[model samples]
Target chain A: MAFPPFAVTVDLVVFTIRDDQLCVLTIERGEAPFAGGQALPGGFVLPDEDLADAAARELAEETGVGKDAELERVHLEQLGTYGDPTRDPRMRTVSVAYLAFAAQLSEPIAGTDAAAAQWMPVASALTTSLAFDHGQILADGLERARAKLEYTTLAATFCRDEFTIADLRHVYELVWDVTIDPRNFHRKVLASEGFVEPTGEQTSQGRGRPAQLFTRGDATQLHPPIRR
Target chain B: MAFPPFAVTVDLVVFTIRDDQLCVLTIERGEAPFAGGQALPGGFVLPDEDLADAAARELAEETGVGKDAELERVHLEQLGTYGDPTRDPRMRTVSVAYLAFAAQLSEPIAGTDAAAAQWMPVASALTTSLAFDHGQILADGLERARAKLEYTTLAATFCRDEFTIADLRHVYELVWDVTIDPRNFHRKVLASEGFVEPTGEQTSQGRGRPAQLFTRGDATQLHPPIRR
Candidate 1:
């Protein structure tokens, strides 16, 4: 029987804020299909599992990060797939790309089958030595994250459940890397009906100004659209 | 050297508007992977080609209706890749799902896979006895198209260059199957900077009220987001 000539790989373009800049988690490959090259952290998907579950499993497996983390939990979503026939050297391989967003991290532990794993600044990651179409995947993921922040309360997903308006603003500022007018930002968030609700609490985060703490609003959409 | 156990296939979730309902192009598989069964129009991706290009090419090769019928003018985009090990009975196959949006069509054609190619309403396509994760892919494509209509002039991508405002409005109404207030739609569309521009023209649609002609706008962002 002629063996089927296809393969499946999972590539993760995990983004996080590091040193006030958007960064991507990537690794130097250790074997063929792209050995000794920088690429997104991923591997062959196993049998008997859903795609999203596999992605989460891979993320934790590689990082050795527990199910829970200190930072506002990272969010993961399916990005577009890439399957240029020649994307891999061994054979025709299709890759499902997933986008992940984590809070600002001190450092990411690059996991197994990788020479090393580290957070590379997105600007630098934009043009890279990524093995396959991962550079494109990384760009796609970052664009998705930026666009998502505009219409959904997703930016808050990158921050803790309890946050000051200032904390919420930082998610936008870091993800978009643009300064948002605080007065305008505050008015916009509060006005978004279910965007953020006052928790009847406050945080002394600024050392002087007692900022009011709020939780994510019940509504899923951001009306009047938060300018990304 | 041991060969990499990977396979690549391209599955098309071809969509069209028929009888004012969303539909997809499908084929009856007569070969092994899913022998004698109904499935999306797809096959093994060949070596030395881009996946998206391959998908579009396959649609044309199978239907003999490329770049002509609005319902066949493949506007293909990657949906997502499925790479679970047990997805294929023979070996590990990574299917890169592609989404295609064609305008309304008159008739269907044969698929390249030596089976009947036909158009079925999106609702019925759901009860598919297809192979792999095609069901999930179809759902994702529909959701993406629905969400995309809110922002980009991507809906225009489903139609020809010069179409009437009523035609455009109908696209939204038909795709979402929701009645959009024509006047409000026109107003909201006109308000969005790059949504629709005055074509300084009209269409003699051979009926009452010759619709006003307009083209896609320049701004990419939908200013004053369109509400669903």
Candidate 2:
């Protein structure tokens, strides 16, 4: 017995902190389906692979960054699925886009199929010619990431594992494009359970006050969330 | 130059209020790809149709609910797209699933393709067999719906244009599965800008004490959002 064949693909919205600004990983598709145009790093999901595995694989493959592989652990999750009939010219495909966030990648590789791979600021990514409905997908991913910071204390993911409150606050300001009230922001961060835990250690960037260092909070969920 | 071929599909996750609990519309698949199993209503997206239009079309075809054919507009939006090359059994297909919130459907007609269409409560829906990863999609949709209530007064879309605070509160209870303090909820509702406004009317409800009625407020967003 045979079923109507299905096509599954993985698109990666890999975001990294570049010059303190959150940017997304993008590639220039060297082939058709908007060939030679800018697009999210993605490709087919093989039969033996799990959906997430496919995304991880496509990400590494499209970026061509990890011939040797970089971080084995990158935060990746299903963003959403887009399957507009006219999205691709060849066959019917249901593309599941995954949103991945990394602290920062320096020597990231380029995909064999890509003309070039680079991290573009989200603002700039919006204006470029994207291969498919990728522009919309990127917008959704960015919105989700921004909203996530409100309650999840996920901004710390953008910083090194250990950072100061000032460093974390800067992430919020950069991502939200709004300067938070430093006093209020500091109070709120400390008050929220599982938001952050202060480390006794102090940073040597002592030109100003020796800022206190901290790590991610113990709690996974935030209550009465913080929003801009 | 021809665009690379793509196979497009539409997956529908229909949410309805059943027994004051959030429920999802599901179908018993008649054929393969998890044949004879319950699944979200979906099919291959047809060319010459937009992604949203395809989802709307699938909703109509599978559940006998169509925007044009019916008087009440179905609250529909792009939930996101899922394209993992192996999600479907046949070939490469990209699927865009729509998240639709229908308050109380007066007419729920099952189309010929599906064996049956039923509103399964979320509690038990998890245990029952769904065709594929539709369960994950359904869960994400519910989570999105729940999160949306925090910042945006979108719950009104689940009710008629004019509703009482009690009705709005009921929506919160149903979606969140948590009881909210009435007095506190009232105060919170009033505090958040553009959440609700007095309709200058009261609902008799065939009772002694009339309840104040309200309509959806302005499009202002919630700051320090209410978490579920």
Candidate 3:
């Protein structure tokens, strides 16, 4: 018995914070099936490449961040796989989607497959119809990111290496689209084991008292997750 | 440029509680590559079938549970996808794995692809060398199940329709392989709103006081999650 063959591809949903808004990287399709339409950067996987390696390779190519050091900071994981019979018009394709979280990243350089690549606010991007089933994939990624912030130290990924409690709180506010009590947020962050470690340095604004700076802690999961 | 064609298959890690121990469904392979070795029940995805539909179909076939009502009670979800180049020696095959949580289920009947099917204790199953990369897949599935119980109302899926607080707590203890204080466990479960709903019924076990009976709640996630 012969099973039908499939073409496996990898699509990336790389997210970052820009100008206090959650943003995702997107590319304009350079060739048909969806030419000129905005879509997540991806392509067919090489025959022998691992699924995760294929995702990372796509991320590097689309972002133009060729250095392993820069890519290492980006938290990447398999979001889900999309394989509707008609998701791809041309062939039977199964797409393994990856979700990535990174601090502010440099402008993306379009790969050979994409006409143009740029960062777009998630809100505005959602309003536009993306090429393929990318709109659904982006929404799923956003939901995962929002939920991850409540239980993981992932919010720190959107901040600088050394940041104040307020800076981290702001990331939560922007991603969750709600205002959080600063004092409560501060208490929770400190209480959660290995969530953050103080740098023993302080940063002062123009008027308020200097705030202690901290770096992301070694622990990835929050024991008592910070509830939304 | 011609890309290599690959075969996509679905593998299930169906878990349940039996004889006070957590068990998983396994089948003895009847084909080459790992003939006679124990493996998860699954098969190739058809050309036009959805990925999830393929998984459900495989589950139905292996268990011989033809009724949809019976299948609906089982909580199934995508675990992850494994596509290591040589994971399958016969060819390059990408396996989309799924994890399922179920209460006590009827004995399984071997499908055409499997020589025999039975429920094996997860502890014992992990000790043996499973076929292909199934051992790794099973480990990942178990980790997902353990972590899910902490934040989601997934533990309820391992219980009967009506159960006492102790019944629910036992599910946690058995799955986590830990002894939890009954009083503390009760308090946490009640505090986590929407974790369970009182059925206004009581069950008298042996000489102990009649414990209140409860059913799975409408909420799928705990707000202040029950921490481990």
Q: Chain B TM per candidate, please? A: 0.86, 0.86, 0.95
Each candidate's DockQ: 0.52, 0.32, 0.79
lDDT of each: 0.75, 0.76, 0.89
Candidate 2: where are CA atoms >4 Å away? A1-8, A29-37, A62-73, A88-94, A197-200, B1-9, B31-37, B67-72, B80-96, B190-201, B215-226
Local error of candidate 2 at B196, Å? 4.3
Instruction: State in Å the error of residue B24, model 3.
Output: 0.5
lDDT of 1 by residue, A26-143 (tens): 8878787678888899876665555677778778766654457632366778887777766776666667888887765445485866788888888888877678778788878888
Best by TM-score: 3
The CAPRI class of candidate 2 is acceptable
- What TM-scores do the predictions have? 0.85, 0.83, 0.93
lDDT per residue for candidate 1 within B1-228, as digits (tens), equals 333556577788877776767778877777876777777877767766778777877878666657565433446677777766677777666777888777654465755545787777888887765666677878887887888777667777666667877788888887787998889888777777777777888888797888778776666557555657
Q: Which residue pairs collide in model 1, if any?
A: A6-B6, A6-B7, A6-B8, A7-B6, A7-B7
Candidate 2 Cα deviation (angstroms), residue B209:
1.5
| Cα error, candidate 2, residue A33 (Å) | 6.6
Cα lDDT of candidate 3 equals: 0.89
In model 3, residue pairs whose N, Cα or C atoms come closer than 3 Å (at least 3 residues apart or on different chains), thus clashing, are none
Q: Write the per-residue lDDT of candidate 2 for residues B1-228, one digit (tens) a residue.
A: 323344566788888776788888888888887878889988765545656777778877766666464425466877766656567776555667788887666655566688887888987787776776787778778887887787776777677667887888888899899999888888888787788888999999876678888887875467546667
Instruction: List the candidate numbers ranked by DockQ, top first.
Output: 3, 1, 2
